[model samples]
Target: MDTTALAHAFTQACTREGFTELVEVEREAHGLWDTHTHPFEAKALILAGEIRIRTEDGTDRTYRAGEVFHLQHEEPHAEWYGPEGVRYLVARRSRAG
Candidate 1:
């Protein structure tokens, strides 16, 4: 599906999953790898391009458009993008649970 349809589907899924907010973000086409942590839980849906994610000491996974990934609260992880960069929709839940 296209970004628009994927965005809408992600919004609906977020609502069902009790996410309080949804945001769409676009990453530029560049090779960047960074490690970070988030205070809230992130449930994201890939809308375009590709992403490779690795937890601090866990397995790594590559996610492409139409794929979904979850990041838990305070989970330290690193990520890098494909040559085309990526566009994704993220839904955030305030509570750790």
Candidate 2:
């Protein structure tokens, strides 16, 4: 789907899934992030370039444009941006007690 249509559908899905916030993020080319955790769960749709994420279990996966990935709240993981950098739309949902 085109970018506009993809974004709309993604937004709707996020809302239906109880995501409270949505944001667009861009990472610099070849950038790497050390293992980290988030307070909220995240679901993202890649819009440009690529990103590879590695979890504590050593499971690594690359997500390219038009692809989606999800991380649960406080799930430790590291990120690497592809040569051309990456851009994606992410939806976040706060963890319930």
Candidate 3:
């Protein structure tokens, strides 16, 4: 699907799934982030370039334009951006008590 359609569909899905926040994110080329965790669950759709994420299990996976990745609340992970950098739309839902 095209970017517009993809974004629309993603938004609808996120809303249905109880995501309360949506945002666009961009990363610099060849950048890296040390392992971290988020208090909220996240779902993202890659829009440009590519990204590699290393999960707590040490498994690394690359996500390129048009792909999607998800992380559960407090799930430890690290990120690496591709040479051309990356952009994505992300939806986040807070963890319930």
lDDT of 1 by residue, 43-72 (tens): 999988988899988879999999999998
lDDT tens digits, residues 3-92, model 3? 889989999999999998999999999999999999999999999999999999988999998899999999999999999999999999
Lowest-sum lDDT 10-residue window in model 3: 1-10
**Residue 23 lDDT, candidate 1, scale 0-100:** 86
TM-score to native of every candidate shown: 0.87, 0.97, 0.96
Alpha-carbon shift of residue 16 in model 1 (angstroms): 2.0
Task: Judge candidate 3 at residue 61 and give its lDDT.
Answer: 99
Q: Candidate 1 overall Cα lDDT vs. reference?
A: 0.86
Please state the error at residue 58 of candidate 2 in Å: 1.5
lDDT tens digits by residue: candidate 2, 5-83: 8988999999999998999999999999999999999999999999999999899999999999999999999999999
Backbone clashes in candidate 2 total 0
Report the candidate with higher lDDT, 1 versus 2.
Answer: 2
Query: What ordering of candidates by TM-score runs from best to worst?
Result: 2, 3, 1
The lDDT-based order of candidates, best leading, equals 2, 3, 1
At residue 36, give the lDDT of candidate 1: 90
lDDT of 3 at 39: 92
